[model samples]
Target: MDLKNKILQTPTGKKLLSEYQLNLLTKNNIETLLDFHDAENQKLNKLLAIKLESVLEIKKELDMLPWQSETFVETVNELDFGTGIEELDKFLDSIAQPFRRGRVWEVCGQTGVGKTQLMYTLALNFVWKHKLQVLFIDTKQDFSTKRIQDMLLERKVDQETSEKAMADIHVVEVLTSEELIEVLKAFDQQMTDDVQAALKTKVVVVDSLAACFVDHRGREMRRTRDSLLTEVACRVRKLAVRGVAFVIGNISFSQDSGTF
Candidate 1:
């Protein structure tokens, strides 16, 4: 008998297997009834393995509950990491909605108008004040450790604290929009897994998001760029919902009328 006939012979298979599954089995080259049986067994085995792994993970978390309660003291308020500038902070606060966690803030301006400088300042402030980690995604390769260090010292932050703050500002350089998407996806996975690094990372700074797509000029390239940007935004929003703040720097350009 054919695979369909054999499958329909069993009440369970007839009820369980959908037309799509039958097509998928044929696509996978499961021609014989024996092949179909083996494929079904493999799928069952994989499902069982996944359930077993989930149970093990739950057990591990239960075992660590006591230790976690003692070690992981949630001291800092995740929503309150502010810009270091007092005037700016005051203005933001006066609006009744300061830059809080679980949100994406864009700093947009013309080139050489201190957009990157502002991003660096925000990253520094986040690390220095909150004692939390900042993920600096530098697309233009403009990240300067010396600049960060000088800013810290100018603030009269001591040697130990300065070094620690800089250490917490993790900088990752990616040249292309595709690369940025990959980094964001990986960071999203890290956050989803509740890894130690992700737990500590309260802010993610993308310095100059425009630089990643500057070379994408043609229509096809522009479409690809837009798709990548959409994906990046989705991933960043997902991370924000997990209580991480995002500060993205973007460049503004003037049209024929000369207004940005």
Candidate 2:
């Protein structure tokens, strides 16, 4: 038999009409199905209502997704990360220039070159001065609350104020490439339009983006790594477009693999 007749003859199709209460008729076919939904025929209308109700319920679930109705802001809040040291602050200012939305900033340096320190200072500035929340992706597991508190104290801020500033910052530790990817995906899910705007969140700092690549090597390593990084960079750019700034930190050990 033909497909339509086969379905009509099947036990499942019978159950759809009897058990599921779907309105199926011999006259109802593909072209007429559209008319069923569009027209006011009682039986066809009932079937359309049943299907549309399920569709509306599915839409309700989709509305709860994290990245819903996010507005893409053209400009972002600019804050200065000025440590007392003139030289360091100048460097910070240079890198963070045009500190607006939709920008993925990569900070590269060698060991002990103050990459983490700079990121911590930026996070502190965002939380304390700009009144913004920061999602700090601590891939290196070296994010120190004590360090933040100490910096706040040095600025003559009281203990309660310092604690409150630290509270605005959320940290996640991801050691492996898989863990990093999973954490980023989870973070994307949890971050909603309302949450981002209400908390004034704009910064996503990934400390040492290269640390996740420790075990990522093989003949296909280059291709896989490139694909992975491209995916991450695309996500970061999208987040940036929605008024979030992504600061990705990386390290280098060789002359050939120096900072670009």
Q: What TM-score does structure 1 among the candidates reach? A: 0.68
lDDT per residue for candidate 1 within 1-260, as digits (tens), equals 46655555455545555676666667778655434323333353343343322323322232222211111123334467678889999998998767777757999988789988888898888887778899999999978999998898898978898889889999999998889878887886776677898788988999878888877756656445544555566566556656778999998777753321
User: What lDDT does the true structure give each of the candidates?
Assistant: 0.69, 0.60
lDDT of 2: 0.60
* Best candidate (score: TM-score): 1
lDDT (Cα, tens digit) per residue for candidate 2, span 79-176: 43333356765775787655555456789988899899888887888677667688899987878888987888899987788878888898888887
- Stretches of candidate 1 off by over 4 Å are 1-78, 257-260
Quote the positional error of residue 80 for candidate 2 in Å: 9.0
Note each model's CA RMSD in angstroms: 13.5, 14.9
Q: What is the lDDT of candidate 1?
A: 0.69
